[model samples]
Target: MEDHQLSKSLQSIGKSCFVKNFELFSDAAISDLDAMQFLMDDQGYEQTGARTRVREGRRIIESGRAKDALKIIADARLEDSTLADKAYRLSL
Candidate 1:
C-alpha cells in the first residue's frame, strides 16, 4: 500500500464515496487510521457490523499490524462480526 490509498481515504471521509480504491498502508499510517476508526466507533451514532469492521480493519492494516490483526480477527470470529469475513481474515 501507499500514501495514495490513504489520501483517497482522507477524501472519502464524512461523505460516503462509493468509488473507493483499495486502501494501501504505510509504516506510520496506522495511527492516523486508528484515529479514524476511533471517530467511527466513538460516535454516538450506531453503525453496522460491516462498517465497524471496515473501519477497524483499515486501522489494523494501515498500522502495519496485519499479522497482529489476524489474531484480532481470530478472536472476533466467534462473534461472527465483519472482521471475521474472509477479506479481513488475513488483514488485506
Candidate 2:
C-alpha cells in the first residue's frame, strides 16, 4: 500500500480499536504491530515526516513516558480525525 493508504489504514484501525474501548496497553500493542508493518512495507517512510512523528510517539510509549505518550497520541489524534474518535472511545 502507498504511504497515504497505509496511514489511512492505521488511522482507521486506531479509531476502530479506540471506539471498541480497547485498553491502552492493547492498543499500544496494535500500534506497535502496525508500525512494524509500515516499516516492513515501506523503507522510504523512515525519512518521511509522518513516520518521524509516529516513531517519536512510539518511542515515548516504549520509554514508559505515559503522560508524554498520551499527549503525543492526543496531538496525533487531532490531526488524523479518526484518532480523536478512538481517543474518545478508548479514554486514553
Candidate 3:
C-alpha cells in the first residue's frame, strides 16, 4: 500500500505492528514513522514515543537486525541532516 494509505490503515495499530509493516513500506517507512511520531508529538506524547522508538531501534541493532535497524536510523536522520549526510558519505 501507498504510505499515506498505510498510515491511515495503521492509525489504530500497535507500534510493533507498525514497525513490522515497515517492510511493506520500503523507502517510505521512514516518512511513515516520522508522521506517526509527529502525530504523537502533536498530541503531547513526544518523549514517550521517542524513547520507545530509540529503545526499539537500539534493540534491533543489538539483536543483529542491522539492515532493519537502518530503517529506524534513516527515519531518525530526518531530524539530523548532518547525520544523514554522514551516513551517505559512509555508505559511499
Residues 1-92, candidate 2, lDDT per residue (tens digit)? 34454445445434333222324333565665565455446533343533444554454335554343334345563556775555544344
Order of the predicted models by TM-score, top scorer first = 2, 3, 1
What C-alpha lDDT, on a 0 to 100 scale, does residue 88 get in candidate 3?
Answer: 39
TM-score of each: 0.29, 0.33, 0.29
In the range 1-92, model 3's lDDT, one tens digit per residue, is 34353333333333343344334333333554564565365544465665454444334334444343334334553545655444334333
User: Can you tell me which runs of candidate 3 are displaced by over 4 Å?
Assistant: 1-45, 71-82, 89-92
Q: In angstroms, what RMSD does candidate 3 have relative to the true structure?
A: 11.7
Scored by lDDT, model 3 comes in at 0.42
Query: Which pairs clash (backbone N, Cα, C closer than 3 Å) in model 3?
Result: none
Best by TM-score: 2
lDDT value, residue 79 of candidate 2: 52
Looking at model 1, residue 23 earns an lDDT score of 41
